[model samples]
Target: MAQTTAKYHCLVTGFGPFYRYTEEENPAWLAVKPLTNSIIEDEQNNVRPIHVSTLQLPVSYQAVMDVVPLLHSHPPVFHPSIAEQAARNGVARPQKGYDFILHVGVAGRGALRVERVAHKFGYNMKDIYGRQAPVVETAPLPVEPEEPGDVPEEVLHISAPQIEQNQLELAEGPEPTPEPIRPKRGFGPGYENFQEEVYSDVNVVSLIRNMKQQNFEDVYLSMDAGHYLPDFIYYCSLAEVIRSVKPYERRRGTQVLVVHVPPVGQPLTSEQVTTALKLIITWVCSELQSIDDTLAKERFQ
Candidate 1:
């Protein structure tokens, strides 16, 4: 038997036309459109060959919600014209899971922004289709998980007579009614307990530093992704990752990141924006590999 080399996979997405930007003027999708089905590598970071798949997301909340889950489970690869030939040649196809998923959108500002968090609700704005996002109420703050060491040291011992009296009183009282379950509004049901805000565990500070080192001077770590389609998609993607993965590994939301890029020639050309995106994808792939390696080591220890 021969050893098989590990291959990394990533999905980078850009937005379609919206507002004043026409189909041809949308810089976000234009920058990434050429890199579809390309491969990126970073020898310095020990990253393997990352197969990149690109998607141009529509400027609609509903469309984004429909596609976000597929990205994590089974997304369509953006293959070139030679895809049929390659398939016939028996080349291996990419699998279901992605090492990282990056969503890119246009921002009014001239700088490149790596968003740190996305809000779960407050998306009151309309999409390109003149449709508003699902109006969801604010979610409650997340409760912290308790560890085994945090258990109480003392336990109350109930007397047999007290227990009998309590049981008799319960039997005498009317039966309690069960509360009806209300299905959440956004992205179907089962998300009633989602957090109000989801944070990406990706190191945005390091990402900004790396962008600056690569001559992208205007790069910044952004706290808010705004309440538009971009933020809506980010929340959808993050929430999907949290729902699919285990609670302990919920921070795997780090594997899903969103970037806000400025319009073309807003102090940066399309070429520069494309270069920055490539760099971002490379860095994220390396970071995810590092996390997996650390978890593997901890498991053995």
Candidate 2:
């Protein structure tokens, strides 16, 4: 029997200490630290082909905007422009590009929340520096031409599927030799007439059900991701996934998820939070593997 290669790549991020929370450690980063470069094993004792890269993001609105574009272009690895800074800090880049993005933050509440939806707009909140965020801000999404004539000639020459293919290729970068025909998940930019909200395109309901089956206590789904950075990051990350990958490939491309954990010494212990993080990561990898296997089977058929 031959050893199998890793099949999936994931990026996990936690916020650095900020504001009033500065006195205590951020539970999100602490929980995620042990998972970096760790391989999860399924029940059969076979290693799940998943590689995780972790990053600690600054607690600033500007930081979110600056980092997201870099993530979109070359995830797990900083863009060339920031390579020096990333290296100086000993940041680890993924062996390859990432297939999933998970943002973890402390909710200061007791339960572990697997967020169901991320609102498109954010409330007026102040960052660490006392800088104020706009009353409402929309994450950038792909825009279609209003008129047929407005379409770019380069884009017009390609068929609908081909256009999607091209977008997928550009998003994944030149290296790693892109996987052919993965299922992409699309997140609609919510309602135009009403307040916009982007739901988690990943199968959260199934994930929650699976968690319950595992007998993990206090794990529940919540519609609100939060009004602050967790919500902002989720919205931006999802928007980037939409802008970067095609609709068909987005489902299989990169799954964006945000997990809100209670602060330490509240109702949950640090160990419990770590357990929840591991559970979420493992489930994500399993789902991606299923998707990959399905696509591979379809190709042969």
- Give the top-scoring candidate (lDDT): 1
Total clashes for model 2: 7
lDDT of 2 by residue, 252-289 (tens): 55788999888887788888888877778888777777
Error of 1 at 109 (Å): 3.4
Q: Which tens-of-lDDT digit does each residue in 61-107 have in candidate 1?
A: 87776666655564333245334633443333355467777899999
Per-model tally of clashing residue pairs? 0, 7
- lDDT of every predicted structure (CA atoms): 0.75, 0.71
Q: Provide TM-scores for the models.
A: 0.73, 0.72
Error of 2 at 298 (Å): 1.5
Clash pairs of candidate 1? none
Q: Which candidate's TM-score is highest?
A: 1
lDDT of model 2, residue 124: 55
Stretches of candidate 1 above 4 Å error? 1-4, 74-96, 137-188, 248-254, 298-301
